[model samples]
Target: MSNSSIYTIQPIEFRLDLKDPFLFTAHHIDHFPAGNTQLGPTVPSTPEKPYQMYYGDVVPGFPEHPHTGFETITLVESGFVDHFDSLGNSGRYAQGDVQWLSTGNGVEHCEMFPLVHQDKENPFELFQIWFNSSPEEKKQDADYKMMWREQIPHVLQTDSNGHQADIRVVSGSFLNTDALSRPPHSWAAAKENRVNIYMIRLEPHAELTIPATTATSTRFAYFYNGPLLYIDGQEIPFKHLVELKPDTEIHLKNSDQVASIMWLEGEPIGAPVAMRGPFVLNSTEELNVAFARYRQTHFGPWPWPTPAPVFPREQERFASYQKGVDVEYPERM
Candidate 1:
């Protein structure tokens, strides 16, 4: 019998992999000379800090930029990301937090990595995925949201041998757990789309089977860091990408080390794509129109104090919307 699941498998190469400033403290003179001040990529760790700056200059982030006709989902694995938008929304979110922005029609935004720690290094790691929007939704107003770490659902499971797995549901439903609410215009918010975004961590030697959901939806797993993972008797090394068929379950076996993987599944919009710089649209005409409009208006003018504006240094994790709605996340233990 032919199995109806598990399709193309590939490896993922990050467009930008950054590990901030490498340390050379007095305690470890052997690793660096007395006055070594150069900065570059460092060893990767679970709690990555002071991530090397992949791009940008003094501020170490993407300063004011324009985006239209698409949405960006930024998952913060470590460190903090400050967001400022033309709509006057601003916030600073850190570890385990997520920022979802809908740049419908047009908008200008900035993502700056602010080193909040004084006595220690400020490490940062994150994934920014862009999702295409439907043509109608692309004309809607922009939406800015912060998915606080505490609000996102974490699903945990253990086997008979005590091996465990934890799945962080960033979007879509996982087992009995539903992802925190998404913006209204998001394609992931529609039930028919079957979009699933999850961060899965498996303990060493653990085994977990992810049940199949929608048969026609697209699904892919990005194994960013791990020793080894076995699927269908195939050995998947670290930094590999595995694509699975949506009709059947996925059996995962972690080798000797902890595994960190990202799961992204969604139905293809199947529309013509015309993308240029920060905008994604249906056709060349639409793309040109988006550019002309932004040039004419500057996306309604950035009202924030700075291009890479951040909240007060003492402020907690919170989002201040343009319409006067403010939501704050309480301090976590």
Candidate 2:
């Protein structure tokens, strides 16, 4: 309840305020109705429900968009995401899967959330994090990788009281578990960067101790879902972000209800950052050049039929890579 491990605590809105090496994080939790003929929400979003259709008229998702100078790590917690990109790659990934897209140089992609189930409610939840790239790496070739749910490591930690904490390692290492390899040009690809993204779910009344990370790394824990959490004996309310001293060990205790937290840690890139819409660059001049180039090239042109494309209802989880062989997962249990 009393410790110097916590630097600050703030409420989280639509996006979590992050530090260097991390540009932005958007948390989407939409309660969509049954699918229409087009597989979109049957009813329009209202002020009360506020089910955002974000650039998608027929679906609740983002249409084809361009990005540069950064990488997008999309973690799907529930529901599914249909992905289409200008590189002639497409995929339909579902719960627990992670998609890492490096828009180096430039790339265009669309992420559509389809209401596949017509008989029941389609509750969608995901976190899309923008990881910043260094100036030199920004000019590298674009790359993409998919870490399926089965490929990702899930570490279970049991406290002395027998309570457990389930941790999903998306990037970087935790305890003895190392995450899958990231893109070659990604800032996280360098071992010295110390970038780590972990999704932790604590059972009711669970207590877990997080070991100290590198002294130079910037770390924060976003408590997105839960009733109550205690950090170092300090009570932390739900939907709050806590900045932690990376060099100090941190203790977490959850209340009676299940609690979930997203922990992000990375060494700062220590570069001038200039962002405009989806483009991120080192300076305003570079940002302008990026826009001009996009207008000229349109990021290799949209290859998909529609800006927001969705797969057939019966199509299972799969990924069609541009330069690699296609992959298909086993049918959902």
TM-score of each: 0.85, 0.96
Instruction: Tally clashes: model 1.
Output: 9
TM-score for candidate 2: 0.96
Query: In model 2, where do residues sit more than 4 Å from their true spots?
Result: 46-48, 323-325, 330-333
- lDDT of each model, Cα atoms only? 0.72, 0.89
C-alpha positional error of residue 196 in candidate 2 after TM-score superposition, expressed in Å: 1.0
lDDT of 1 by residue, 141-194 (tens): 999888888889999999778999999999988898999888999887886787
The alpha-carbon deviation from the true structure for residue 171 of candidate 2, after best TM-score superposition, in angstroms, is 0.6
The best candidate in terms of lDDT:
2
Please write out the lDDT profile of model 2 over residues 26-74, one tens digit for every residue. 9988888888778888777677665778888888889999999999999
* Cα RMSD for predicted model 1: 7.4
